[model samples]
Target: MAKGQDLRMTQEAHVTQGPLTTEAGAPVADNQNSETAGVGGPVLVQDQHLLEKLAHFNRERIPERVVHARGAGAYGTFTVTADVTKYTRAAFLSEVGKQTETFLRFSTVAGNLGAADAVRDPRGFALKFYTEEGNYDLVGNNTPVFFIRDAIKFPDFIHTQKRDPYTGSTEADNVWDFWSLSPESTHQVTWLFGDRGIPASYRHMDGFGSHTYQWNNEAGEVFWVKYHFKTDQGIKCLTAEEAEVLAGKDPDSHQRDLREAIERGEFPSWTVGVQIMPAAEAANYRFNPFDLTKVWPHADYPVIEIGKLELNRNPENIFAEVEQSIFSPAHFVPGIGPSPDKMLQGRLFAYGDAHRYRVGINADHLPVNRPHATVAHTHGRDGHLYDGRHKGAKNYEPNSFGGPFQTGRPLWQGIPVTGVTGETVTPVHAEDNDFVQAGNLYRLMTEEEKERLVGNLAGAISQVSRDDIAERAINNFRQADADFGKRLEAAVQALRG
Candidate 1:
């Protein structure tokens, strides 16, 4: 703990709602004093109120997220500026000048709840759009491409980031060992060690819907789409020294900066843009557009600006509003849907399952997660922390007693699947070679940026005890770019000496 910092928690200044009452609604006589034998005798065990308070307090914290445990969020407005009704029938994007209420959460991918905010990590850019139809979520990241194209490797990749079970401390060796062995990670690893890895602030970093999504028009024309939230603050980064010093000086620097900016009426904003492709174009593209490890180059399909995003309000209670907020890819509207991206396909099920376990089954009923529009039909009830709605009603459908019925929403035409049914590796596409894009990204870096990238990679690789793993990592970079490979090797050798 920092000097003069109290380990004890200060009392909450503000709380929600009316006078404190028992869970069953009997008025409490006194909250401050617990039942006890007269004047310093044995404390009574039959103190129901005291027991309830302590028990609830003990169980207050749910499981910290597997990834993205530390985060900051704000309430925002996403206003449509250009009509894209021909591309998507989602009500929020149906007309110009239409506004949709939104909540956006920014988080570090691998950090624990207490980790520093300014560390070199990809920030999660998740937004929930409470449209008239239903709540639609765009779960994305600060970077466009990912470490792996398949979700099956997600657990193993996360295991590398987390504290070593044996040592209970993060080891650089574990991270590099995995990355060196898994050649698929080359592109994202290049990105991680680049100039933009340590974003100056949440406001300055751009966000991408890392996986391709499917969108359909009212006329049932389907097109693959990707979202890009270009930050109005402009791109900025912190060098290694600056980030280290700031992390020690103020762990919550990013969180504080955002809140203070909003309070001063300096609202942070992003221009909502998208790179759209015709549904048939994926097959003929140089790379499989559905591959999560690759991105659709902007030169081919330029970003089309469609809306504006501004965060004007901070949360009233961080825990209640921000921490409890949930975003899932499965929460799609009629027009916007998922693609054949394997990672996305897995996330469609995995995200909701994780929420149900971490939050309750009725997580959607939470104010932050709930829709502003009326839900015509909702299934499943009777869970912990359930909202007091649909009482004494049939939980199932197809009942005669005026039960909730499904709306006649048009389902998009299904894409044909031709793969053999079995547990197997993702088939090698013609452009499955991951080195091309990583090399392209490396070549795009300025001379100074390239120097820093080599330094960053060397710093981590030098800590790796295994010579073979270190050599393999260098070889991966060599595959990316010859100059990059030699520079990193020379840097690491200097560090070793």
Candidate 2:
């Protein structure tokens, strides 16, 4: 019945659309049987259909992402709720009630394409805003802080999360060994082993633009900012037991829950807000403003509501729209730009480079990733699957051809750098102690929350066969808080017994 409807629809669309055609547009008479020498003989060389089918099937899949491979996406709308014209010159936030189309991809870090959706990992909360200016991708995570501050450690950190090469299994020794040495990972480690590690659903947890960004106004005034998408459904989490049960029962539980809810018209929404810091204040701030491993306290920089995002539509083709969708932190409009955050700076190059290798050179030409606004790029002329052209126009810039060209727009200029350039490390600030924030977070948790965190941490840490690695992990926690360390030590010992 489905085949008949598809064929009927195809037939009504074009003159030569109904019949199954070969690559050369020649119609196939018998798709069921291949041309052969005889009834019992091998297939004939003239079987183009068979060859085409097998060849295409071999190249069907592209390389999965190095990280955040397992993901779900949706289409949405972002409507501005406040006047932020004074803060940013971005067209999407230009007015009080302006609307912009968006795409949100939620995923688990360090997970493979087949990993359970309820696994204990940092949830990737990436959003792409398709505005009149261009695509502005706010690549972030569910948590405000990250495991590391420097981009140099990212590859090594992710390697620990992946399977060990020799055994092809996740090893707790590797995870704990790395985290125990890298003290910067303390804050994020505290978050991941907590109750919030296994979120009830993607829509139930808050999203954050983890890195501080730079926003410039029309008046050339600049401000450092961070974005937060507070979930309207409220924060919810599953216990370790609940997560394990659901993983065994339905590996793609979160995906199913989100899809079904949207299909039933139960749209999920988030209140978009920003924590703005003045350009000069960033220098005077107690902590280094660009540290990816730390978070600016809400009390110091209040989260001012700016807009609302509602996911009203699910993807029609998950593989085409969701899987093929690509985003880069470098994809910023005129009003917004990057900060000096090391991780973010690395991603600015890493994402585009990965997309070119994993997706294709012309990934931007794909429907889901293609810009909705008019594009006049001529520099990228030819590559695999090239489908665009700037006919009669010079490919090189500085040509005297009457064409769309780069506009020399004024930048939001304020501060100037006067520093030595070389193999330099991050300058230590007076408030650079990582344990302080982690301790604060541990202290803020309720008694029940603290107990759950200890249990979760113990369950994972106890898996480490080496007592040295386990003790190292405990020592790091001890530095954060004596009580946290004491509870975790007892729980892990109990698990071992």
Candidate 3:
């Protein structure tokens, strides 16, 4: 008998209803198969439901990021553990026990969307904090420093890391050639080849606001700050061989690990710390504090513990929450602002521009990137695919109808500047030796770690075509550590033999 007739008859005996129906209240018929041309031919294009499904599927993917294309994300909360109101009047860090919802994305640089998780590359560590003031994005990286301080070399550096135009594959010569020419990359290259390069898992790594940023107070006091998110889970890494095996065994290992951990209630957490430098100290500092390629030594500026961030929730839908998410360093609240870091200043524009291209002009309207607090006024009119509810209110600012206006207070502190405006190479200080910290880091490693580091370096460097380029790259290692250079040279020679 038909199910509808059976249901009606059984209703006399108080039987329950069946499954839900379609939009027209008609019971769905044969959801497993689409209406096709006579059982075994082409599918009929006239089937509206089938056409709708296929059309949506075809447009499911958006443009991948130019860099940091592969990533994993989760939702979490940040709890203030210490009062930092003296430095900055940001509400989220002002009071102890105050909690704010946040979303974080950890990614690998120089990889496509389908790349391996264990590549020896810098990881993007970006956070979006939904505070009462607004959504403040701390777009950063796993390492505390970058390859170059200037923005002009960014495009060139990225090109070298990407696939070669002729071979359509990663060219080690291209990578080392760029590094050899640009000495500023020494510090970051040291970190990349070290044990921390191939982090065992995302939870076992730290995150850093690599560039110095500004923190302003209500009293107009400004402080330069560097953010550090120390992993409560502690640092862990895989050997080069182990990482290679895992890349083949599980390309999505990091993503799967995160999801499973959250499901099993093993939430990951990190302690938030900051190194603050006075606005007046930038001029007299031994090293240029604003340079993205350098670090302010702990002896000069120590870290102050401020809060804890705990990731307790996995996104229900990865595409909607993680893939569509966007973060920009320019997204700042009243108390926070950008520093004079050249590379950082470029990223402040580049990140937003990339997001607009990959996602949409209305990308901010997406649920993941949207501000939790109500947006009072924005002059941004319409663009491709806008989802915001724009009522009859006047769209333009400075209107008679009380549109959002500036508060008239200085958003950041004005530091003293006394240099003449001219086009010339700025003189680097005598103490700005990029090789020192790198050498120190190399010397600190254990014998086994050193061997693995040498092997890893040689494995990539041996693939380079030019012998002089290889020698120059080895010389960089020699500058860092003599034994490091000797071991890497032996490894490469053996490979050639």
Candidate 4:
């Protein structure tokens, strides 16, 4: 089924007038009672339907995602509102007013499957655009920056965010200890503890493609771009107190709010924009343009409006649509590719591998993950959930019987590389320290916002048992800004003392 194609064409009504049947389509005479020996002694093994039902029920669930476990998703459309051909030749973005079908999933980063929705955590903003060429997935977060720039440290970072091995609970010592050691975490930590940390609802927060991506035009000109999806519903946030109350009162607060709003026909939308930099300007820039921990300040490159995204429909089945759905940053259309951002590069491999291990290799055959506009003609076959859709077709290329061949044109322009790669720290640019941007963020906040940030930090830092760990964490902020550190240290001391 292609984008804009009728849903009725592919989907059939699940409820029918026929009697209840077994997996083999054989009608079952009695579904209510299981077969037993003489009606009471023992359940009989001869009841194939009973045995089958129990077995299937036992195996109903796939593994939950390691991250973004608790999430809500919706079906939507992304309409290109402005011409961006000068930047890229991606088919979906080739013309103004071109609309593409989309599925957006919002989630809390560090939460479990049963966690509360209103927690003070970064939100996942993963979007899948089913386009004419193929599916383009922009898996991102609400914040524009992350704790670390290198992917090598990602697992370690997430481990600290997750439960402690011994305590079986997240420890303040583990979290602050890692943050203090990794100075790169300062910027994201500041953002995490700020006013917007606890979004009131998924609909009211902004979304970002947090890594730098590559866009190329027809003439093979390359550009580095960052995506921004500003909420049309306006920015709304819950204070720490409000979030605690809401989380306890309604763990599904954000999820329910999104569903009810769409149900009421008040579709939440976002003004889509991008900040683009010429590939030539990447080097010699004030900061490392490819760093995942930094944002391309709006002062250097302003966001240009290009599209609109609105979520209008909730999924009929959460498990089949939301849980089974996968988004990989590696999913790219023509003219769009990844940058040298180490985190982005690592994710290119990790995301797909995780999905293959969790969902079967034929996971894409699931309707929600399938390509809409085009038929995928890959050689991959015969995995779990395999339907044999490509039966009798030659599975290999270079065959006389007309197998699918590769397109001669590359999806994105390639860059030149000269150095032998080993374990090497990324070459630093001017103004590339980890603390500057974080300190700058602190200074940019309003007085009230700064107070809240300090209070949040102090509350968490004071929980650490070791004074050395607390002081080390405070010193990072002090390096970022003296005022920030002073206020935070005073607050922590007052609480701890």
Candidate 5:
């Protein structure tokens, strides 16, 4: 029994191999029928086994996630390929050729547990690395930018994406109305309506740690970094028509594709890279580096190739590995820490809290989420599923008997801050206008891509019942680029008519 060994690789002797038994391990005399009083009289209340079976069956289900409920996961390895000690002293990236066990879960943002996977929505790229220091989770999305920059607007943004309380369905009016009011959503709106909106499969799309994060070296030099996981399978996407047909035919299209691909021994992989910005340069950058609505152009900070990630195995039990898994951006190791990204800051608390409520407080003690290389020593004890591994050890620190003590070293470096802390807007950067990057993205597209994007936007916007809502949404695009707006308006009008 090695620490954190994959359950699939272990010997099956521990599994049930004998006659059918109750949960208490007692052999059952009869399992086919309930122990009724002598040939179908009133069923006996003394049938403990029957009661146990019925009770367990009734308690089988757990609450599904509010978002990202439709998901698939696989076990993988992340091997560092380049030296990056100058940027971060994280032990997982301490040297070239360092390999770490990883589990990656890909999911749709707004889908329910039974929702079709081929919908046009952002995919969650949640990766958990079981490193020697501790588990490090990089929870991100397929898109590099998001709809909103601040955390307070997150609930409102999601409310639009979800089913309307009154309509009992995801109304186009609610969605367009929210986006129309929030001009900051323009950049991500452009992405969502583009060709990449509906990914052909999980393996065919790239992943991004969309928010800026902090990395520090042993010498205390800090650098702001963004992560990119480029799919080695190459980018593949589905058109709106193609996605609709696929979803209708196979609701689990993306899940089946990923599973069958790995079953054929064709493992999917990604070329991992990061764009590093020195700490000193972040203050006066052209755009606010911490803005979740914006992306730092490759021209400003070139991506540095660092590692390779390969998914080699699929989970034997989907319930144990995929459904029960948890990830949080706050799960960082030494040298890696949070930046001032407002969205990221809010997620640091929200994600962990969600898991605590959804999965038990001892969710981390589960083999899927636990550390592989080292045991976690903590004072917290006695919760649902707690293994009681710390038997008889003094729970309190600084006891007469030897007890675990702190090392007096912080895992991450701190930053200098000033000014009063209150409800204040983000500090303005010189080139922080919301529409500039959206316009740039529109301009970068080919003529055909531009046409498809316009068609997608128009089709959805035209569905809105209110003319004011549709116009406001179109005006945001118009602000991005005049030509783009004109074409979109004409297309929307034709569809409306």
Candidate 6:
């Protein structure tokens, strides 16, 4: 034996198990084959193990997400580079150089689970930070704005973007009709058809909170902030033709690329930044800061670099860590809370509710959604597939038998609101012109990018059977820019001819 090698041996050291066993510890027989009717016949249902495996497989799939069904995820770390404790009391951001374990999921909205990864759709950029206080989930998207600001129209808008019931395929008419009728969608629609629409890959795109959120400090001073995860790899995009070919050639392009990149040690990273606006400024801002369809121009509120996010680990199990992962905008730690963003307010309920329906009441018990910090108190108990961690602890609160007691300090300071309670429309800002930003974005595009944008829009719009729908969509584009509408119209007409 080598000098460093252990040469000692014991009689029982090499003992091994006879065979595999069931979950109940019963030794499994005929391990090499399933109990079937014959060597080449149908599988026998009487084989409990086989039945269990098949049954589990059949029900393994949960309800696909209503939006952002196609996604790829990885584990990463977020390190704070700046001190913003005066702005937020969140423990993760309290000190410079603090790091938090994070999981990020990038997705394509309006695509099914098996759909093409390179589809022309807005991508979901959701991040969950495992902090000592609790998990903070920043559920956002690639675009800085959304199609609709109001939650009531969200379902309707999603229905339009999805496959048409009659045709079982995406119809441009369905999408355009809804967009033309809902003027609020104009801003996001312009972005959807622009150069940034078809991102080259998940790593090459930026992520935005899209809605304003409130951050409160220990002194109870609150500030409205927006998160921006600017890709360190720089923004890159695929042209319409390139995207289409890639989609056809490899529907799992983005997913495979992320996994292979990590395996090759080429970890992707992003610079975490924030645009903070004083609560007082929001009251006088030119645009409604809470509107989901508008972005606070970087010039008005410059981005302050906060930290960096580097994704270095691929999930060990896709189903457990990636598929079953749940994130809600409602999941906020101290110092962070929702703003008056209407869509966000609705999501605070909708996301949690969706998780309950899809992943059960104990969705939080799942390893992916579970917080790294210990949970001392919870009123919720005895749901489907409960793991029974509560054990002998009292289930009810406010009891004298050593039940959990409430803390005196509030989670965060609430913003003061003195308004009438009535069914009235939200007040629009005085300088709210939906076309200005869209026009500016269009003008900012390079000539080649603009050509691709025009071609992409014309190609899709030309597929609409209804001439009026196409015309209405073109008219909205015309409102943004005359040249844009003219070019799109010409391309669309040429295709029709």
Query: What does the lDDT come to for candidate 6?
Result: 0.81
Clash number for candidate 4? 0
For model 2 the local lDDT of residue 151 reads 59
lDDT (10s digit) by residue, model 2, range 1-497: 69999998788786544787767788866543344333312233355565554333323335887788899999999999999999899888999889999999999988889999988999999898887877889999999999987655666688799899779998889999999888889899999988788899988999999998989999888999999999999999999899999999999988998899899999999999999999888766888888888999999999999999999999999999988899999898888987777667667666777787778888888878877765536567778767756555667777777655778884334345544332234545678787989999999999999998998889889999999899889888999999999988999999998
Backbone clash numbers for all candidates listed:
0, 0, 0, 0, 0, 0
Per-residue CA lDDT of model 6 for 51-114, tens digit only, reads: 4433332232368776777999999999999999989999999889999999999999888889
Q: What's the residue-level lDDT of 266 in candidate 2?
A: 95
TM-score of each: 0.86, 0.86, 0.85, 0.87, 0.87, 0.86
- The segments of candidate 1 whose C-alpha lies over 4 angstroms from its true place after superposition are 1-62, 408-412
Clashing pairs in 2: none
lDDT values, one for every candidate: 0.83, 0.83, 0.80, 0.87, 0.87, 0.81
Angstrom error at residue 242, model 5 = 0.5
lDDT of 3 by residue, 392-488 (tens): 7688767898877777765566555444332223235547676766777788788987887787788888888899988888888788778877888
Better of 4 and 6 by lDDT: 4
Instruction: Residues 1-497, candidate 1: write the lDDT tens digits.
Output: 65344323222322235676777777777653344343212223465665554444323336877888889999899999998989998888888999999999999988888899999999999999988988999999999999987665566678798889789888888999989888878999999999999998999999999899989998888998999999999999999999999999999988898899999999999999999999987777778787788888899889999999999999999988887888899888888888877678657656776777778788888888889865636657778788768878888887888987876775344565553333334445566687989999999999998999999999999999988999999999999899999999999999988
Cα displacement (angstroms), candidate 6, residue 101, comes to 0.4
Pick by TM-score: 2 or 4, better one? 4
- Residue lDDT tens for model 4, 275-390: 99999998779998888889999999999999999999999999999999999999999999988776786677667767877787888889999998787888888979999999
Query: Least lDDT summed over 10 consecutive residues: which range in candidate 5?
Result: 35-44
